[model samples]
Target chain A: MTAKITVEPSQKRQQAKQLREQQLLILAQQILQQDGFAGLTMDRLTALSSVSKGTIYNHFCSKEDLFTALSVDSLQRQLQLFQRALQIPGHSREQVLALHLAYHRFSMTEPTLFLCLLTATTPAVVEKSSPARLALRQQLELQLAAICQQLITAAIAEGSLQLAAGQSVDALAFVQWAQAFGANALLKPTQQLGLFSQLQPQPTMLLGVNLLLDGLNWKPLSSDWDYHASWQRIMTILATEAPGADGQLN
Target chain B: MTAKITVEPSQKRQQAKQLREQQLLILAQQILQQDGFAGLTMDRLTALSSVSKGTIYNHFCSKEDLFTALSVDSLQRQLQLFQRALQIPGHSREQVLALHLAYHRFSMTEPTLFLCLLTATTPAVVEKSSPARLALRQQLELQLAAICQQLITAAIAEGSLQLAAGQSVDALAFVQWAQAFGANALLKPTQQLGLFSQLQPQPTMLLGVNLLLDGLNWKPLSSDWDYHASWQRIMTILATEAPGADGQLN
Candidate 1:
C-alpha cells in the first residue's frame, strides 16, 4: 500500500484565509501610502481593492484591526531587510551596522509606510484593535527582536563586542533598536525643521551606532577601525538586495 | 539720565497674544491628557475655557495649529528640564546623563504630552499647521538642541569626551540627542509589549549613554568607574530640582 502525507481540512482553510488576508494587505498598504490613516476607511479599501467589504471584514474585524495588520506587514518587510543585511559577509558588529543601514533605507524608501507603522501604534489604534491582532503584532515584534538578539550573542561569542558588568544581551539589543529608530524617525523631521541642518541621517546614525558600540567596548572600536568604509560596504550590500537603493540615500 | 524701555504697539500686541496662547495651551493639554487627541476640539475648548471661538482662532489658525503650539510648549518645558539638569553639580558626563534622566522622567511623568509631540511631527499635522506656527515650533526645537549642544561642548572641552577623526561638535550633539530620544521613546512600549520585560528604562538608557560615551572614550567609562553610582548621584541631584522625583523611578 502507498501512503501519502495530506493537509487537514482546517489547515487548508486557514491557509486560504491567510492568502486572502495577504492580498487585502497589499492593497491596504497602497491606500495607506496614498491617503494615510484617516483615509483608510473600510469603504475606501473595499472600493479600491475590489475585495468585497464582507471578505475584508472576514480578514479584519475593524479598520483599526486592518491598521494593525498593516503594521505587522510593515514590520515583516523591515525584518526581511534586516535578514538581508545579515547575509552581507562581515563580523557581527558589521552585521548590526548593516541592520541599522537597512532600517534607514527602509525608512527613506517608503516614509509613508513608516508613518503607517507609527500611526498603528497610537493609543487610538491600539485601544480599538482586536486582542488577537495585537497579539500577532507583538509576536512579529518579538521575531524582529530575536534577529537582533542573535547578532548581539554572536558579537559576544566572537569577541567583537563585550557586555559591561551587569549588562545583558537583551538590554543591548533594545538599545540598538531604539537608537536606530530614533535616528531614522527623528532625524528626517529635525532636518526638515531646519534645526539640525548639518545633521545628515545616514552619517549621524552611523556615528551614533559607532559611539554606542564603542561604549560597549566592542572590539576594534570605530576609533581603531573605519566604520565609514564599513558603511560604504553595507550600502553596496544593501544595493544588491534592492536595486537603485544608492539613489535613495542622501 | 535713566532711559525708559518702552513697549511698542506691535510688541504689546505680541505680548498679549503670547499670554492668550499660553492660557489656551494649558486647557488644550488638559483635554489632550484626559480625553486624547480626538476629543480635543475647538468646540470643547470654547466650552471648557470660555474663550470665544474668534479669540481662539485669532491665536491659532486651526486646531492643528493649536496642537503645534502645544508641541512648542512641551519642548519648552523639556528645555527647562535640561537647563535644570545642567545645573546639577557634576562633571560634564554626569551633566549629560542628568539630561538623559530628565528626559526619562519627563516622558514617564506625562506620557500624553510626549505622545502629543510625536503626533505633532506627523505629515498630516505638519501639512495643515500655519507657516508662522511651524517656524515657531522649529525655533523651539532649535532652542532645545542648543541646550544639548552646550552639554556636548562642555564634555569635549573638559576632556570628558574625545571626538574621533572627522566628527564635529554638531554631529556628536545630534548623536546624543538621537540616542537619548531613541532610548526613552522606544522603551515604554517595548516593555508594554512584553518583549523586553527585564529592561528598565533608566538603567537601559544609562547603559546606552555609557556605551556611546565610551565610544567617544569619555573618561571614567563604565568599566573604569561605577557609573551606576554616578547614576544614583545624578538622581539625587535631580530630586532637589523637583521634589518627589525619587518616588517616580523604578
Candidate 2:
C-alpha cells in the first residue's frame, strides 16, 4: 500500500512537470507572435510563465534551446499536416501540391512560428542547440521527406512523371521541397521590396510546381490541361485557407 | 577665384564623406564575418571604425539600418556578379544555369554576407530600416530581376523555351529565382540537419534547375544533351570556384 502511494506521487509530479513545460511553450509562442524574435528574452519568459529561472533552465537549457524546442514543436505540427495531406484524394502531382499547400497554410497561420523555424537554421542557433533537440529536428525532417518520397514514387508509377537520366526520386523530392521553401520564404520580402506585384502565393507556388512538372514531362501537361483549376481543387480538398482569386482566404 | 575655392571645399567634403562611408561599411563587414549578427552593435562599430556614435548614426540610422546597408552592399555585389555571369557565352538556358552557378559561388565564398542579406528580410530588421535604404534595396532587387528577365526573354525568343498558357515571363523568372534561393538557403541547413548525406549544393542545384527547365520542356532536353557537361563548361566560362567532380572548389 505504501509503495503504491509513493508511486502515485511520482506519477503526479511527472504529469505536473509536463503540464508546466507545455504551458511555457504556449506562452513563448504567444510572445513570439506578439513581438518578433527580439522580444523573446529569458527574463520575459520567466516573468510570463511565473516559473523561476532555475525551473525554466531545467525545462530548457538556454533561450536558443527553448526556441529550438519550439521549432521542433512546429516541425511536429508540419509532420502531422503533411500526413493529413496524404489522405486528401488526388493525383500524385496534385498530392504533392497539396503538401505544398499544407506548408503554405501553416506559414500563413503561424508566421512567427515559421520564422522561428527559419531562425533555428542559423549557425548561431544550430551551434547552441542541444544535441538531442537537433537530432529530433532531423528525425522530424526525415519523416516529412518520406511522405514526399511516397508521392513522387506514386507519380512515377502512375506514368504521370518520369525521372531524368541521372535524377533520383530523392533528388527530385529535395528540389520540390527547396522550391516550395524558397517561394514561401521569399514571398513577403520580395513583395515588400516591390519586386513581384500581385503575387498570389498559392497560384504562384502551383505555377512553379506546374512548370517544374511540365519540365519533367509529367503528363496532363499544363498545355493539355488546366493545372490552375487543379490548384483550386487541391486547396479545397486540403481544406486550406489559401487565398483565392480575390486573395481572400475562404 | 573665391567662388572656385568654395566649390572645391564642397567637392572635397563630398569625396571625404563617401570615403568615410565606404570605410565604415568595410569594417562592418569584417565585424559581421568574425562574429554573427548578435556581435554587431553600435558600440562595436564605433570601436572598430574609430568613428563616433554620432557619425555612425549619420551613416546608418540604427543597428538594423546598418545591417540593411550591409544587405544593400551584398545585393550590389550580386548584381555585379550576375552581370558578369551574363557575359559567359552559352545558350540562353546555359546562361541561366551560369547565373545560378554565379550565385552558388557567391553563397559558398561569402556565406556570412549571404546570411546578412537573409537577415535583412526579417521583420525586425525590415521594420526598423529607413525608407531610403528600403527603396535602394528594392531598386537593386529589380535590377537583379531584370537581368534574369533578360535571360528568360532570350530563351523564349530563341525557341529554346516556352511559356505555359497564361504564364508570364515575370512569373517564370520569379519561379526560377525562388528555386535558386530555396536550394541555396536550404543547402546548409539540410546538410546540418543530416537529412541528406549526399546533398552536393552544386549538383543538387543544377539538378533542380535542370528538372525545372526540363519540366518547361526547354529544348535540348536532358535526355538529348548532357547538361552536366554544360554545367562544368559554365564553371569554366564564368571562372567560378564551383566544386570539381570531387566536390572541391577550384
Candidate 3:
C-alpha cells in the first residue's frame, strides 16, 4: 500500500508533464502556421503560453529543439496516416499507391508541418537539435521506410512483383520514396509558377507513380488495368475516414 | 557619326555597370560559400567589396533579390550543362539519362547554388524578389524544361516511346524533373543519415532514371540492353568534357 502511494504520485507527475508538452507543441505549431520559421522564437512561445518560462525551457532547450520536436510530431502523424492507408482493402500495389496518396494528403493538409520535415533535415537544424529528439526523428523515419519495405516484401512474396537480379528491396523502396518525395515537393511550387497551366488535365503525381510501378513490371500494369479507377476509389475511402481533411483531391 | 559618338559613352557606362554587377555577384557567392545564407547581408557585402553601399544596393534591391539573381546565374550554368550533355553521341534515351547525370553533377558540385534555386522558389523569397529577376528565373526554367521535352518528343517521333492517351509531353517532362529533383535533394541528407549503408552496392540515382525510362517503354530498355554500361559511357564522356567537376560519381 505504501509503494502504490509512492508510485501513483510519480505516475501522475509524468502524465502531467506529457500533457504540458503536448500543449506546447500545439502552440508551437500555431506560431509556425501564423509566422513561419523566422517568427517561431523561444520568447514568443514563452510569452504566448500560460506556462512559466522555466517549464517551457524544460520541455525544449532551444528553438531548434522545438523544431525537431515539431518534426517528430508531424512524422508521427504521417505514420498514423500510413497505417490507416494500409488498412484499406486492396492488392499490395494499390496499398503502395494508397501510401503515396496518404503522403500527398499529408503534404496538402499540413503544409507547414511538411515544411518542418524538410527544414529539420537541413544541417543547421540537425546540428542544433537535441540528440534525443534527433534519434526519435530518425526512428520515426525508419518506421515509415519499414512500412513501405513491408508492402514491397509482401508483393514479392505473393508473386505480384519481381525484382531484377541486381535490385534489392531497400533500393527499390528508396526509389519509390524518392519519386513520391519529388512529386509532392515539386507539386505546389511548380503549380504556383503556372508551369502546368499549359499541360493537359491529367494528374501528374498519379502518372509518375504509375510509370514507376509499371517499370517494376508489377502486376496490373497501367496498360493492363485502370489504375485511375483504383486511385479514385482509394480517395473516396480515405475521405470517408477523415472527412473534410482534404477536399482538394482532384 | 554624331549619333555614334553620342552613343559610345553611354554604351561604355552600361558595360562598366555590368562589370561591377558581375563582380558583386562573385563576391556574394564567396560569402554564401564561406558563411551560408544567414551570414549573407548587404552590410557584409558592402564591407567586403570595393564598391560603396549605394552602388551595391543599385545592383540588388534586397537580399532576396540578390538570392534571385544568384539562382538565375545557377540556372544559366545548368542550361549550358544540358546543352553539353545533348552533344554526346547516343540514342535520345541515352541523351535523356545524360541530362539526369548532368543535373546530378551540378547538384553535387554546387550544392549551395542548387539550394539557392530551391529557396528562390519559396513564397517569401519570390514575394521580395524584383519582378525582372523572377521573370528571368522562370524563363530559364522553361528553357530547361524545353530541353527535356524535346528529348521526349524525339523519342516518341522516332517510335522509341509512346505516351498513354492522357499523358502529355509537358506532364512527362514535369514527372522526370520531379524524380531528378527529389533524388538529388534527398541524396545528401539521407546519405548523411546512413540510410543506404545497409543496402547493396548500387547507383541509386541511375536506378531511378532507368526505372522511369523503362516505365515509358523507351527503346533499349534496361531488360534488353545494359543501361549500366550506357551510364558509364555517358559519365566518361561527360568527365572528359568537365574534368574534375565531379570526382565522386559512382
Candidate 4:
C-alpha cells in the first residue's frame, strides 16, 4: 500500500491532510451505512479509514463534528437535487411529483445512507444533536416551501388558481412535508401501505400544492384576514374544555 | 428464591401447567420493557419466572412463539379498541380524528409492546414471516374502512363533496396512516435531537395533520361534508404512513 517512498515535508502535509479528511468521511459513512450511527467510534474510524488517531484529530474537533459533516453533506445533496429539479419546467404538481420520485429513488439507491440519515436506529448517532435533525427538517421544509410557492405562483400566473381563506402557500408546504415524512416513516418493502400506493407521492406531495390549486376552485378559497378567527377556534379547542376530552398533548 | 416447597407430584404438575401460559407472557413483557425484546430468552424466562426449563418448553415452542403471543395480544387490543370506537356516533371526520388520537395514545402508553409488534429493524422480518404484518395491517384497515365509509356517508349526506378521481376510504385511511408515520419517524426526544430544540414533534405532527385535512377537504364551507372531509384528509396524511416503508408497499 505504500507506493510513495519520499516527499517534501510541505507536500506530505498537504497530502496527509486531504487523505485524513477523506478517511474520516469514508469511515463516517461506513459507520452510518454498515454499523448504524450508534456503532461509529474513533476506534472503528481508525480501523476503517486506515489512518492514525492523531490524523483524525487534525481534521475534526470531535465525533460530533465528524457527524455534522456527514449530515451537512446529505442535506446539501437533497437541497441541490431539489433545486435542480425546480429549474425544470412543468406543472407545479408535476414538479412536486418529480421531486418525490427523486426522493424515492434516492432513498432506495442509497439505502444505508438514506436510512442512516432518516432513521433513528442508525448507530454512531446522537439523537439529541440539533445540528443533525433540525437542519435536516428545516432544509427539507425550505425545498418544499419553494415548491409550494412555485406552484402557487405558476397557477396564479395562468389564472387557474383558487384558494379558500386558510390556504396560504407556507401552510401548504408544511402539509406536503408532513405527508412526505409520513410516507417515509411507514414504508416497508412487502406490505403495500394500502391506499397511498396509488396517488404516487411524486404528484400528490403537492398535497400543499394541490391544496392551493384545488382550493382555488372553492368559493371561499382566498388569502383573507381571518387568521384570528381560525386561531381563536383552534385555541378554544386547545385551551378550553371539550367535554370528556383526555389525551396527552405534545 | 425458592420457598418452602412441599407439593405432591400431581399438584406440582397441575400448577406448572396452569401457571405456564400466564407466567411466560408476564416474563416476556417484563423482559421487553426492562431490557428490550433482546433480553427475552427461554433461559432468561426459566430463571426469571422461576419455572423449570422443561415447563417453559411445554408452554412456548420457542422465543418466537412467545413473541408471537405478545404480538397477538397487542393486535387484539388494537382490534377491539377500533371495533369499540366504531360503535360510537360521530361524523366521519370526528371518528378519524379519534382514531389518530387513539393511535398516538397507544404508542405513547405501550411503547414496548408497540415495538415488538410493529418496529421491525431486521430486513427479513416481513418477508420471512408476514402473517403478523398482514393480520395487523388488515385489522387496522377494518377500522379505517369504517371511517372512510362514514366520511363518504357524511359528505354525500351534506351534498358538498367533490373528489378528484380516485378516492376510497381505504385509500384515505392509508394516506392518513402513512402521513402520521412520516411525521412521527422524524421525531426525536425533544431536548436532544440536535441544535434545534423548538422544532419539536407536537407542532411537526400538527403540521402534517393540518395539511392532510386541508388536502382532503373536498367540500364547500356551507356543508358538514367540508369538516368531515377536512378531518379525514388530516387522518390520511398523518396516520397512513407509520408502518415504515422499507419493506412495505404504500
State every prediction's TM-score relative to the real structure.
0.87, 0.87, 0.88, 0.55
- Note the Cα lDDT for every prediction shown: 0.79, 0.81, 0.83, 0.51
Of 3 and 4, the candidate ahead on lDDT is 3
Off by over 4 Å in 4: A1-76, A89-101, A121-174, A190-250, B1-77, B110-118, B121-162, B187-207, B218-250
Q: What is the lDDT of residue B185 in candidate 1?
A: 70
- The number of the candidate with the highest lDDT is 3
Name the candidate that leads on DockQ: 2
Candidate 3 residue lDDT tens string, A81-196: 89989999999889988999999888888988887776676544666678888888878888998998899999999999998876789888888988888877777767766666
Looking at candidate 2 chain A, the ten consecutive residues that score lowest on lDDT are A241-250
lDDT tens per residue, model 4, A43-116: 78887776688877666656655655565455555565565555555444445544554555455555655544
DockQ of candidates 1 onward, in order? 0.50, 0.52, 0.44, 0.13
lDDT of 2: 0.81
- RMSD of each predicted structure: 5.4, 5.1, 4.5, 14.3
lDDT of 3 at A49: 95
Which lDDT value does model 1 have at B28?
A: 88
Native A-B contact fraction in model 1: 0.63
**lDDT for each residue of candidate 2 in B1-250, tens digit (9 for 90 to 100):** 5999899999999899878987898888888788876577789889877779998899888888988888898888788778778887777877888889889878888888788787787766787889999999999999999998888898889899887666778888889999988888888778867777686677788888887887777887777877799889877766643233122223
- Model 2 Cα shift for residue B114 (angstroms): 1.1
CA lDDT of A246 in candidate 4?
29
Ranking by DockQ: 2, 1, 3, 4
